[model samples]
Target chain A: MKIVLSATGPGFEAAVDERFGRCPYFLYIDSETLEIEATDNPGEKASGGAGIVAAQAVADKDVKAVLTGHIGPNAHEVLSKAGIKMFTDVTGKVREAVESFKSGNLKESTGPTVAGHFGKGPRV
Target chain B: MIISIASGKGGTGKTLVATSLALSLSENHRVQLLDCDVEEPNAHIFLKPIFDKRETASIPVPVVDEEKCTHCGECSRVCVYNALAVLKTAVMTFPELCHGCGACAYLCPEKAINEELRGIGVIEIGRSGSVDFVHGVLNVGEAMAPPVIRQVKKHIFSDGISIIDASPGTSCPVIEAVKGSDYCLLVTDPTPFGLNDLALAVEAVRSLQIPCGVIINRSDVNDSQIEAYCDRENIPMLMKIPLDIEIAKLYSRGIPLVLGISEWKDRFIDLFEDICACVKQEAI
Candidate 1:
């Protein structure tokens, strides 16, 4: 089985990003072999609907689950409809979150944690 | 001629200037006022139109037929706004993100998608004294304002003068309101924040290649750098309104300046004349 984690940096040692839609990096992992691959999130700089595009990209990857710090209603709906279980409120390093997921320590989120456009911070 | 009043900075008195100008000019011209600031439309509070006509404003959003959908992801691939998502067994639509471009339904491989009109707001049209009034009330939680703004602009008095009150900021909705105006009157303040946003508003207008002028509201409150910038840009400073407590008091009471102070009516008329002169010069 494969899973994806929204991360701030490239590897398992990196911290999990609080925003799933606009996270800079995504770490795709094979649950059994523990192999990891990191890539840029395609929806990172979307003008709008970052969650929609991010959800689409994840669904295309055929991932069984998603591990992230937070999820929005749009992304949550897409993930739920895709039948992909979402484990949220994740913190600390990606490796630790993965370990917790593998050990069945993480709780599946029933719904979105925040509102839309919550990831958009103050403009420069 | 169609003239739009805009300000990059909020609370710079765009509505105050718009309402006064529309009221003052209606005596001689068949003037129309469009409150294009759909999200927080306030001109209605001042004009208090009779609202003879009201209709729902909507945009086309896609609705998919699950039975016909093959879950091929074609509609998702064609949507640039990320309004659609196709999973293996299901498809999702985010109507708020949809621009209503109809690309999704047009490109759906199995012809499963159908376009539906989703209500975003309501457009109201009526009479206020001699002026024709139109404004849009955007539904709460709706992110799209351009469609509603466009609906209001459709009521423009083409034979006479049309004065549009646009929303603050240099965003898509502002562009939709200010586009195709014969002239743009940019209301701004003398403060630093005002000047910064005014520059952005100016860029937005210039990008559209529309001729614009500036109106300095509360001109005596701060440094005169905004004047300096206007001079540097060669954009005419059409009028100036000093920081007067009486004017603020009138505005707070929803009384337009021209109505509260009869003496100010001539000033607004003069301002309209100056705008006409500027538009004439640009035509040359």
Candidate 2:
């Protein structure tokens, strides 16, 4: 199974970013093999609906789960509807977050972890 | 003439001025008051119009016909809002994310996309005595306000003066209501935040080439910075409504200032005349 982690860079050693919608990068990792594939977050600069767009991008990758610090309501709805479980309030490096997930240390989010416009730019 | 009352910040007395001006002007001419602040319209509280017509405002959202859809992700790729998503076998549409732009339907290669009407808000039309009253109420949690505001602007009366109470902000909704008006009244307080936002609001109105003036609400509460800014910007200081506890108390009770104070009625009438003069001056 593949899992996604919001990251600050394109590597497992990169720190996990707190924002799910406009995070800098998304690290897709193999659950069993621990191999990683990272891609830049495409919704980083969206004017609005960044969360929904980011969730769609992750869904397209066919990830079974996502680990991030916060998930906005719209993204949470889209991901949950796609049957992709979300573990939120995650911290530390991408590798450590994966280990915590393996040991089931992270709590599954039943709803949005943050309010709308949480990932908005300075102007908004 | 269509005049819009706007403010870059909330609680700057846009509705207060708008309602009173409409009331005072109705005595001598045909006046229509449109509350385009769909998110939280408060003009009804003061005007107390007897609404006889309620119309649901809707926008066209794309609906996909799955039978002919190829699931090629064409529609998803074209949607700037990311409202559409393509799974392996089907397309998922998020109606909330859609802006009713019709781009997806237009770009669909399989001819499976069609448009459907989705209600976003409601429009109430009625009369408070001789003055016509109209307002738009956006459904709760609805982010797109421009569509509803546009619907209210469509009801602008051409024969007589139209007074539009725009939502407080310099964003899309305010722009939708204030644009194309004969003049705009930017009501603001005398404070740093008020001045900052007033500048933004002024820029927005000027960009549309609309003549605008300033109304200093609570004018005595602060310094002369607002007046200085107006002079520098070449914007006329049309009026100054001093900070009055009695006025605030009346507003809290849903009474317009012109009705509660009586003297303000004539002042608002004069304000309207000054606006007409400004409009005529701009024409020459």
Candidate 3:
């Protein structure tokens, strides 16, 4: 099974970004071989519905699960309907997060972890 | 004439100018006031129109007929808003994100899409004496305001002057409210933030090819750089209402300055006259 991790940078050593939709990069990690490929998140700069757009991107990659710090309501709905399991409230490095997932140490989120537009820029 | 009172920044007296102008004009001329700031409409707080007519505003969002849908993903591809998603076996529709552009239903090859109206807000119409008052109240959490603003504008009385109270900023809702007006009155202060937003609002108005004038609210509080900018742009500086503690107190009490000060009523009339002159000059 392949899992997508919202990352702060382009490698498995990079820290896991807390922002699911607006995170700068995402790591597509292969569960069996532990290979990692990173891609820029297009939804980072979206004016609205960033979560939904980000969910669509991950769903298109045919990932079985998403590992992120938070998933918004819209994104949760999309990924849930697509039959992709979400593991949220994830922290630390991408490599550690993947290891946690493999050992079932990470929590499987039943619903959205954060509200819409969470961690988007500085707060007013 | 349709005169839109717009501001680049919020709390710069767009409603103050619009309501006072409408009240002043209604003394001698037929006037209609449209509060197009659906997100946080406050014009009724001052105008206090006894709303007698209420109508709901809706947008037509696509509803997929699953029986006929082939899951081709065409509808999802055409939607710019990402409101539609075609999954393995079903199509998901997010009505809140939809702009109601009708591209999804129109381009569905399987002929399985139909539109259903989703209520976004309500338009309330009544009379504040002779001035017809119309305003839109957007449903809480509804991201779309332009649709409700358009619905409020539909009730505009063409035989009289229509003063549109536009929401702040140069975004979609502001554009929807200010576009197609005979003249746009941009409200601003003399601060840097005010100047920057004023420039944006001016550009938006000019891009729409509408004549625009400036109203410097709290003119005495800051430097005169806004005046310099207006002169450089060759846009008329219509009026300057200085910041006054009395005016602020009255506004806090939901009382229009024109109603509280009485003499300022004539000032608003002058403002309207200047707008007419600017519009006439542009016509020529």
The candidate that achieves the highest DockQ relative to the unseen native structure: 1
Off by over 4 Å in 3: A35-37, A122-124, B221-223
lDDT of 1 at B106: 93
- Quick one: how many clashes does candidate 2 have? 0
Candidate 3 per-residue lDDT over residues B1-284, each given as its tens digit: 79999989899999999989998889899999999999999999999899899998999999999999999889988888888888778788999999999999999999999999999999999989888999999999999999999899898876889999999999999999999899999999888999999999999999999999999998895647898898899988888888889999999999998999999998998888888888888889
Query: Per-residue error at B107 for model 2, in Å?
Result: 1.7
Task: Compute the interface RMSD for each candidate structure.
Answer: 0.8, 1.9, 1.3
Error of 2 at B17 (Å): 1.2
In model 1, which runs have C-alpha deviations exceeding 4 angstroms?
A122-124, B221-223
Q: Which CAPRI tier for candidate 3?
A: medium
Clashing pairs in 1: none
Distance from true position, residue B279, model 1, in Å?
1.3
Per residue, candidate 1 scores C-alpha lDDT tens digits across A1-124 of 8999999999989999989998999899998899999988877998888898898888888899999988999999988888889999999999999999999999899999999887776423
lDDT of 1 at A102: 93
For each candidate, the DockQ is 0.83, 0.44, 0.52
Query: For chain B alone, what TM-score does every candidate structure achieve against the true structure?
Result: 0.97, 0.97, 0.97
For model 2, the superposed segments whose C-alpha errors exceed 4 Å read: A1-3, A30-35, A62-91, A96-124, B221-223
Clashing pairs in 2: none
Error of 2 at A51 (Å): 3.6
